[model samples]
Target: MLKKTLLAAGTAAALSFAGAAQADIIDLFTTDQNALILTDVGGPIFSQVSGANILGGFRDIGLQVFSDTGSPAARAIVEVSGGVFTFSNDNGIGGQATIQWDGGTDALDPGVLNTTGLGGVDLLAASADRFILDVLTADLGFPFQLRATDMLGGDFTISLTSAGPGTFEIPFAAFVGVDFSQIGSLSAVINTAGDTLALDLSVASIVTNQVPEPAVLSLLGLGLLGFGITSLRKTKTA
Candidate 1:
């Protein structure tokens, strides 16, 4: 009797765990995925970059990065690395963006320069940063638009990795529609990049520290205990 009961219970627990995976929204990635859309450029986001050591900053800038096309929530990974000739931010690392982009002398795009204030920004060839995104099929429908305001004010360079199909590159990119622009009532100018970013979602991902929900975990544990009992009963009966 105990053996029979344990077998049944064990089977039940294994099935329960399997059901949990199916019940999930079929999502992947981390909460940091939103970082894929760079925004709110400012002193708070970065300090300053020097050829030798990264300098501190005294300002804040606001900004945002997004893809003009495709669905939001899709699985994707962003890779940002900086050094001497790579993507660098915040004093050539992951501290600050590299410029100012509002208007005038400190205007953004190609005219950006190092200043004492936060405005627009970009990463350099010596820094690295990353963000990952993953949304299931249910996350699709309307376009995926995430915004990050220029809280500080400086330029930043980010490498966006995506799961959507695109050009010849991995994760695709030909018709990826990477339209990076400033948001405003009258549509601001978008500075085109001079470098090629390498973000292959097929091989990159981020690790997060978020813990699984306790209730869910407890349920999972209970399911296993039930299954084990069921199995033991089955063995004893045999």
Candidate 2:
């Protein structure tokens, strides 16, 4: 019954907010340790910190597709739930992960932080996860591409299926800083166990800065509905 209500609410919200330019993910990364994190752009602001780690296992082989717009068939957005953009990504031979965002306001934080280090990370020399980030655009509605962000700007695409079936990356962490101009402070963690991986955020520790549009609209609609319904009832009784 609750699920039904939420679905109806979401649909109604989508309708009222038609032409409100929805947000989509810009990138998703799944490691050999089987860990995944989705980065998105141009939508509503959303963020969560981990009170615990979310775990899951996946296959060793999959797809790598891209879309030009919001379509996964044309380019890559986010979310790595087994047959999305990176369908064969489970054990892809060569692939890349690209991410960037800026909702109407700041949405989810791109930074993933760690106090107790995660395993299998290709880390930086500072004892923290030092990722090589390159800004590709200021446009928030287009598809972002992931490539070999090497010194030579070489074309060394990553293949998840590198060596042994269980072989994976190293131990390290990633800190994706969201734009400070909008909303700020989103820390995350990525871990791996065998063929699967996990994402842990510092949710219970930080302040939630953004609210999804659907929730806000629902509250407003309910207020209006109650006012109308009460007026009708009062007139009937009178």
Candidate 3:
């Protein structure tokens, strides 16, 4: 009887530990405009554009004019429609543009992307996590480079091919080295080679495994020790 009790307790404890270490997936795009922090242009406003499901039936759009000499002064807009986001120059201006998603001050610190607002728990700082983006190109032959920069000044470049009308899942593993305690902002930039280079992006996220607390680990160890002691007592009696 004691052996059976110990076996059941051990099994339950192991299962609990496994459950505590599960991975979490966070959605990067949403109807909440506060979730995004944009710079280098006018209002990064949200509206119902003539596109498909960008997110919850609407998309965020913004326009900016660069006067950095020899560049077109037309208002270039970054718009999302039907889950697809496109960046193009309205006045045939060809230059560089940037878009960023800020987790918000309530969820993340200024210039920090830590796990504070992530369910009030801490995550493993050095886990092999992935930052995923669903993206494609408007021109099937135009190739462009997208750069992702983190708060700690870490830049990872992803070269996109134009063999795409269908959205492809691009997973960036460079986020594994990020400081989870002070995770900052996530931004993407593209330098247009011509007057127009339309790249569509959707569904950005970060997936990572959770870390168990020290108190939880102590409880697990105690449970195992109790089980072992009970099993030894049963063996002596038998």
Candidate 4:
């Protein structure tokens, strides 16, 4: 009964302000160690951080550790259940990890992706006007590629430099040939340049939405939804 009421109330609140553009934060992936599963691996062909590690409704995400260049044969110790996705490389194998976010439910698919609008929310449309990729901590000279796939299988790639304790604003105009309104998924391909490297990475989006305004709060009339208010701000600091 309580769950039904909360859901109904939330729907009302959303409909009440459907015409307005609100500021909100869309958490893509968080590596907070407080609640995580400790998985230790060495050169894993395919591995994933499931259960609580994956956010609700975005169940198809995947994490893969690999060597970009196969010659050196990179061996990595990966820790995905913590404040950072730690990738420790022993040799100069150019260690890297691929974060697959394109929503796919195929059980055989190694690269799992996220399902679009499963929660009745258009991630890109409901969030802020700008998209800022926030990487909390990482080794120096770390490089990554952020790929955005659309409904038609078209992709837009953005090369990212590791700016630990800071944020990078992805330019809106850079996503050429991509439909912003109908985005399918987003993948982060992270890499380490050093021979022996210890890289810690956490990815998220810092968006601007206007849900905490007094007018909206007063209309919602539910304190249980206070958690949403707290999510408006970034929990991690640089």
Candidate 5:
């Protein structure tokens, strides 16, 4: 009777934990699966690049760079390729994006989702516990904001302090008035801050993190306890 009870408990725990683990992660985007490349040319008043990520329902990945002086003859190059977003000012000689300057030079990379991409529109945000972004930057020139918006126009913005490299995890509760079931997009903006002549930003991946509920945790613990008792009983009997 003792052996049977222990075996049953362990089996039940394992099954429960396995089921919860299946829903623990949802991939948003990864370069190994999709790639977006963009670049700017000299003498263009407005230069931009945009494309689909081809993963999680073909979400859009785009970037835009323009002259601060509104000149059709300025030379500044900004590009994103091989997962790295590079902004170069040509050693301060070129009129590159001065993010906070009145000249209006800046960069915008709007990572817009397909809404109905990740498992459908209803479950996209509802199923996700939090959003995660994996990035590496070389002291970003200015403060940047990661903004998320829902289909209903409700939005939330997360500020990212200047850092070299790190992972950002945003909880769903942080968003105000945003409908989780109707998530629309995520965008990054660096519009109102001092600019650095040269900057490199690399994005590794983006994903969601989901954790098992309390009941699942309890089940896991019970399973471990049962296994320990069973082992002890067998050793003593032998």
Candidate 6:
């Protein structure tokens, strides 16, 4: 009887382990005005990037000015107006902004999802399997780059060209050898010559996959312990 109980527990645990795969959805934009803004030590959602360092700034990120409230809450919609890039801080100088998705080390924070510890390869593979971007605009400029950076400072960039704008599935497979475990942030940068470029772009949604919690491991361990206890009882009875 005890042996049977042990075998049943082991089988149940194995089934649980197999079913551990799950999906986590993160919304970049919401109708809630009080939504938690993505930020890091650099600043709020928008910041100025110079020489690998992000500085605090409002308009520097170029996102605050281009937002579409008319869009549905299912995704964030942004439209870029005309902006000139200047070197003297008079206009804007090749703007780039980073939005941190995994809230760093703050357990109590609302944005905390605790994904930095996941294995890089696992994260990237999972994301690649389930990643989608819905773009609602017709023009997103020419030669814009979308970048994802890991905690180890490894960056994978994808150069995007305007295809008359529609739902775009991000080529997560392009991020080969990236440390997905520490996927710290996502950024967008526009490359233009002569420090002046006309801008028109819009993004509707960004959806990606993430690993499930480690709770299943604990449950498996418990199941194993129970199985061991049952086996010991069977040995004593015999």
Off by over 4 Å in 6: 1-23, 31-130, 190-198, 209-238
Which of the two, 2 or 6, has more lDDT? 6
Model 4 scores worst on lDDT over the 10 consecutive residues at 1-10
Off by over 4 Å in 2: 1-51, 54-73, 80-95, 98-164, 169-238
Candidate 3: lDDT of 86? 51
lDDT (C-alpha, whole model) for all candidates: 0.20, 0.20, 0.33, 0.41, 0.37, 0.32
Q: Tell me the lDDT of model 5 at 155.
A: 55
Query: Which residue runs does candidate 3 get wrong by more than 4 Å?
Result: 1-28, 32-75, 81-84, 105-128, 140-163, 169-171, 174-182, 192-238
| Model number with the top lDDT | 4
lDDT by residue (96-198, candidate 2, tens digit) is 2322221112213322221112221121222221121111111111111111211111122111211111101111111122111221111211111112111
Error of 4 at 41 (Å): 13
* Total clashes in model 3, counting residue pairs 3 or more apart in sequence or in different chains: 9
Which portions of model 4 miss their true places by more than 4 Å? 1-44, 49-56, 59-75, 90-93, 112-121, 192-238
Judged by TM-score relative to the true structure, which candidate is superior, 1 or 4? 4
TM-score (all chains, Cα) for each model? 0.17, 0.19, 0.39, 0.53, 0.48, 0.41
Off by over 4 Å in 1: 1-52, 56-62, 74-238
lDDT per residue as tens, model 5, 176-213: 55565765544444422324332334444455545447
- For each of the candidates, the C-alpha root-mean-square deviation to the true structure, in angstroms, is 23.7, 22.3, 20.1, 14.6, 19.1, 21.3
Candidate 1, overall lDDT? Answer: 0.20
Q: Worst lDDT window (10 residues) for model 6?
A: 1-10
Q: How far does residue 76 in candidate 4 sit from its true spot (Å)?
A: 1.8
**Compared with the true structure, what per-residue lDDT tens digits does model 1 show for residues 95-130?**
112222222222332223333222333321112111
- TM-score, predicted candidate 2 vs. hidden true structure: 0.19
Score residue 84 of candidate 1 by CA lDDT: 14
